[model samples]
Target: MSPRNPMNARKQRIDDLAASSVVVDDAGTVDEAPGVSLIASAWRRLRRDPVFLLGAAITGLFILVAIIAPWIAPHDPDARLLIDQVSRQSNPIPGPQAGFPLGGDDRGRDLLSRLIVGSRQTLLVGVAATLLGLLGGLILGILAGAFGGAVDSFVMRAVDVMLSIPSLLLAVSIAALARQPSQWTVIIAIAVVQIPIFARLLRGSMLAQRSSDHVLAARALGVKRSAIIFRHMVPNSLGPVIVQSTLVLATSIIDAAALSFLGLGNPDDAKPEWGQMLGQAQQYIQDYPHLAIYPALCIVFVALGFTLMGESLREALDPKSRR
Candidate 1:
């Protein structure tokens, strides 16, 4: 064969390389790169783990129900019906005429509506408390871990003290001190109770990441300490923090519900809260079992969703767990 031109040979080589390379067309931008597609790769890995898939599905369902509660709930959560009142008073049998698919509360509110609304309240409290705790903990924990000395000792000792106190008792005391326990009060109480947990987890994570080569190199490059700690160190150490935060959310919700059940939460007349409903249902337990059964199931299902999701996330994110 005749010798090929240098340019032709180069063109053929380039075409062959292009044929083997991965091409990603995102919107109008064409990217020819050799990297795993995020969705496909994630789906493949998740499909290999049945437990993780189940957890993800449950978590997603709970989130969907929470977001669409108002539209999906059959009765107006605030609406009161005469049938509901009679049903609550008469120890009536469970049926559609009772104005409740589940049953009515002592106040004649629809149990299902209340449960739907309660999901929103529980999720709100859990997320708000977790975020607040995570923010405060990450800052203090990273500061303590990255700069180990008197600061570390002082912060950890404080954490130890907080950890020693029973979280429920501390929340109760705080709630009692507050003249009126509003939603914000409950959130704050939960956040305060959870701070030590997040702080301890984040502190340990930061301590581990601080010795990593990237962190050492960043320090060697004379990056500002604040930037190194917050921008670099915190981000790198967030895997465990994210997993812990998820678990904390489940615990916070349960704790908040417990506080409400104990009458240390939003006022008694508030629309619907799982804990409050559970507390109210106690009076009518024998008469209308569904009233309590439904809300208890809600709490169980939601708590289970969060627990499963947290476990899945922990396994996915933690190197130790992966092995």
Candidate 2:
């Protein structure tokens, strides 16, 4: 019909090709490929927040230091040198032996080396205590929130009793009662103090989530109570829990250090732990300032790292921030 008008002819040809094209069904769902893209997205969001980015970077550096301390430390953490025994007096000359890059403690042990090794113990105690607290809190919180009756009353009252007791006081009492507070003992003490806070936070979050529309829908669908609580409820409630856990980690580190400083932590001869190092350095603060300075700096940096990471996580997990 007049050569099918040139444009119409092209359109007809495209339609014919489309009609002949094969249709492949996509069975693959979005959930099937949760990959590095999610992490990349998270990193991008973190980059947008300068405070969060700085915190994450510092945290990552500390973790790397903890991992590689064995190789990176310049000298034996426990190595004691008596070559300059007479130079123990704080000399203003800053001798090679006396003023090490970070200087030596009164005992002649390398402060830098001890700081490096000490990170391991501090991180171990913090992470372990946080995990133990998390496990105890999760179960108690979930039960109280999901059931919401006698279980809730009992759990909340127990939490109240714990809250009434100051955390530091409780940790101190437990540490003293244990006779000798080993690493594990410190971990247990910290966890015990942390559990009440975790339980309360988790229970409150769970209670809030329990009344959400998705929860109501799951209930209406006749899903088993356990499944509703664990699968549907817990996952949704993890946002705040994760944020709180990070903060708790920082707190645990400080608590561990405090215990060690107070002689409620590692043995006197234990390999370089930050708290123990601080305790040792305190005696020589005026004579060898570097001894105290290095260890104290380590604590500050590690604590700052955890604090930043916690803030970032809190912001990321917040629903308002997401919007």
Candidate 3:
């Protein structure tokens, strides 16, 4: 046997694994280290990545706080425990005292408790909107990708029309036009704005995979057209879409907050959303900066966490990242 044959075999193996993740050991042997699907590989990468870890920590802590708010909050978020403190006389909005750390809002509610409880509303809105958009996008993207020509053209053109408008402006318009403003209005508006984005991304990804080897091989074999599409093409194409969903969660949160701030959020002040809290604090912002600062910081930090996780996931799932 020629020594070069072994080298050629090794080279062949390298080429085979090139499209996937490869690990080279000290012996110089190549192995498909993460012998798993794209999602499994991405999860492995996520576990080891500091950026993802930090983001996960922030995001997880937020979820935990939201879930346990009722148990951990020092006072009832809606109670006017400190209404006397803000009587517009001596102590106009008292600063942090015994029970009320971070002081009282103009409404005399415990600011700390409202901030804690508000996480539930924010998370609910963000998750709901993202899921809604993801569902709509999946349907449109599948139709366009699975059936090309007319369907593809029609869907793409419609998506193009949506893309032409600024996302925020579109959301604000939709939210503002609603007969009654509430969290559902914010959710619907945000979801509508997000649908086009997700649809376009999925369609592009599916199109790229349409001509790939696995798809062509399935066609060559006797796989049903629908089976080839859903079983192979759609699964393979979902990597980018999943990554985009994470990013959209952050965007949805921010969008929901924006609508809420613009008086388009839940009208029930008793619920105490972070965005509404921040909005209401504007008038008293001059004297009581903490009112605006706390909720604003919460929004920024949570958004940052999601954005970080999304970016890290994107990098992790990228085929180019395989080594």
**Model 2 / residue 105 / CA error / Å:** 1.6
lDDT of 3: 0.90
Candidate 1 weakest lDDT stretch, 10 residues: 87-96
> Candidate 3, residues 1-323: lDDT per residue as tens digits?
74568888999988888878656555575556645987787888889999999998999999999899889988999998988778776667878999887988877889899999999999999999999999999999999988989999999999999989999999999998999999899999999999998898889889998999988998899899999889998998898999899899998999988899899999998888888888898888988888899999999999999999999989988978643
Cα lDDT tens digits for candidate 1, 1-323: 98889999999999998889666665386669777753455455656777776767877887788889889887887766534345534545344454466755555557677788778887888899899988889877986888999999999999999889999999888788888877778889988988888888888988888889988998899999889888888887787888888788888888888888888888844567788777776776885677778777877777787787778767765546663
C-alpha positional error of residue 70 in candidate 2 after TM-score superposition, expressed in Å: 1.0
Model 1 stretches astray by more than 4 angstroms = 1-44, 83-89, 92-99, 268-270
User: Which scores better on TM-score, 1 or 3?
Assistant: 3
Candidate 1: residue 101 lDDT (0-100): 69
Q: List the residue pairs that clash in candidate 3.
A: none
- Candidate 2 structure quality by residue, lDDT tens digits, 149-187: 999999999999988999988998888888776888889
Task: List clash counts for every candidate, in order.
Answer: 0, 0, 0
Task: Compute each candidate's TM-score over C-alphas.
Answer: 0.82, 0.81, 0.87
- lDDT for 220 in candidate 1 is 94
Highest lDDT: give the candidate number: 3
